[model samples]
Target: MSRVDSNNERLMILSDVTKVYPMGDTQVEALRGVNLQIKSREFIAVLGPSGSGKSTIMHILGCLDTPTSGTYHLDGAAIQGLNPNELAEIRNRKIGFVFQSFHLLPRATACENVELPMVFAGINATDRKACAERVLDQVGLKERTRHLPNELSGGERQRVAIARALVNRPSILLADEPTGNLDSRSGAEILALFEELHTEGRTVILVTHDEMIASRAQRVIRILDGRIGQGSSDNHGRKE
Candidate 1:
């Protein structure tokens, strides 16, 4: 049987994208004329200052928000004007999210937290359990599957979050400040895991403000005042 990924076209495409938000009589442009493309297995870092629109770009790429203008294409599907349901479908099937806070339920065990998305997607009980367990194991949390969020260390909790993000086999992994809350050692471990995932041919977009961490990515995109800064590149190593 042919692998499903053999059919993958370009993973993502964005052209002249701009996102504007209206507040009272003023309009704030969160993203301005952003043009970008990401291939199937690239590791990219979106780097910028606090108000520089890195998060905005991540949201648009993850299908959580639509651009006010211009076009977006994900895995060959045009997403310019897709409605909420369509956007949700694309997010569920193609994008996985990892945030700095982990976002695990305080009362739920690690396995249960990892299984929530599959449950929402109507996966069978047995399949959900198996899938969650496998992913937790992948994130090195097999022994802590039964522990609740408060019982795990910071690193372990983030690992659980990563497991939850990976449970659905999504085509793209979006990590927003993934190591922000961890110490240097733990952050290093998480970065190593990202590199491992990249080596395994996953499309990983890491959003961060730290230059050291951003440098670890194969390509780095820096945004400033809602516009692309100098670091944006067409090829991984090419500036133009």
Candidate 2:
């Protein structure tokens, strides 16, 4: 596998970021002064146990939420204060998300499921179908394009999810515990596919709690107590 070159352009920067949530009369800080940088074409894992605020970080990175304090710059554009509609636009244009649950619509075929994002983006039927088939072929699911989720195996379903994620050709592919529901063999296949995508120059950020899973990335960022710890290291134990 090709590693992320240190000279790659910077894709994202988080400066002293923080996130807060309100509960009744109490306020909870989900992230506390976290700073991070990610480069284009980098495959990295955000590793954290439950309640460590990794999900908050993911939300911020994915443009699903904004920071409570500090600044986030994606591709040189400030992201901390964008409105919901603006954020949604950025998400549709720049980020692709894959979740553990393989959120495929039960009534849709693989091709139709992959075409949903383009449908939202107002892509016409012909282009949507073409792009969907192209990505499904890229993900090794061309033959299964007509199959529904229930007709596929766990790995195949996840592949369809991946195809859906990639159909937009987003700059960053963010996967949250992507293999959490798969058997070991299927999970390995998905990881291999991720590596393949990384080699093809896609920026992949995998948010996972499993050490073994995190270890597959080129670098790992560990979060604890809503803060980025000193344990952010490469696979060889070098600080990133």
Candidate 3:
């Protein structure tokens, strides 16, 4: 896997990106010539209602899918032309994803769950455990490392998921409706954690439909009808 250059300021750029799916004889346009750019260490929120292409955009940005047309550049690398193996390599090395579903293995302990990514990366057992514990502690779940998913609260489980995502030290953190399954307080706590990560200089992209949730981000980019709507300025009031 190629390492993303730390000196590169533009972390992601999508120009005239579009995605289409064929259903029977009809074609569905999920994204319509979307254009977006995200710089390093920016906390951005992509907000849209259900079936509004937000999820599709997230998939493409996360390298889970490719654009049908146009270009996507990530950390100075052209992404749309990469093969499946190359895409997977980039996703594993440079992107961390936290979804609405905790997606934790029911049988695995918090430490084990967080170790899965490193496992796939071919890290040895000792290092994987150590890294997992360190990240779990970073997420404030140090004492619960031995606990299973069912034993942890919703927020704690989400924290474990976040810890898993961070275990690899990816260049970008992509979260899709991360707080959707938690209570209001839990959700707030998760958002706080995201903010803390952002302050630590991680590029965090949050995808959600909730205004209140989206408001927590430094910048909010609204999406509607498969296209980007007006976007708010960054926290410093500077437009990117």
lDDT of 1: 0.88
Which model, 1 or 2, shows the larger TM-score? Answer: 2
Q: Write the per-residue lDDT of candidate 3 for residues 1-240, one digit (tens) a residue.
A: 013336547789999999999989999999999999888988999999998899999999999999999999998899988999999888888899998989999999999999998988999999999999999999999899999999999999999999999999997999999999999999999999998998898999999999988877878888898899876545444431
Give the TM-score of each candidate: 0.91, 0.93, 0.92
lDDT of 2: 0.91
lDDT of 2 at 131: 93
Residue lDDT tens for model 2, 1-240: 135444676799999999999989999999999999998888899999999999889989999999999999999999977888899888888999898999999999999999999988999999999999999999989899999999999999999999988888897999999999999999999999998988888999999999998988988999999999887887734424
How accurate locally, in lDDT, is each candidate? Answer: 0.88, 0.91, 0.91
RMSD of each: 4.3, 2.9, 4.2
Clashes of 1: 0
Worst 10 residues of 3 by lDDT: 231-240
Which segments of model 3 are wrong by more than 4 Å?
Answer: 1-8, 231-233, 238-240
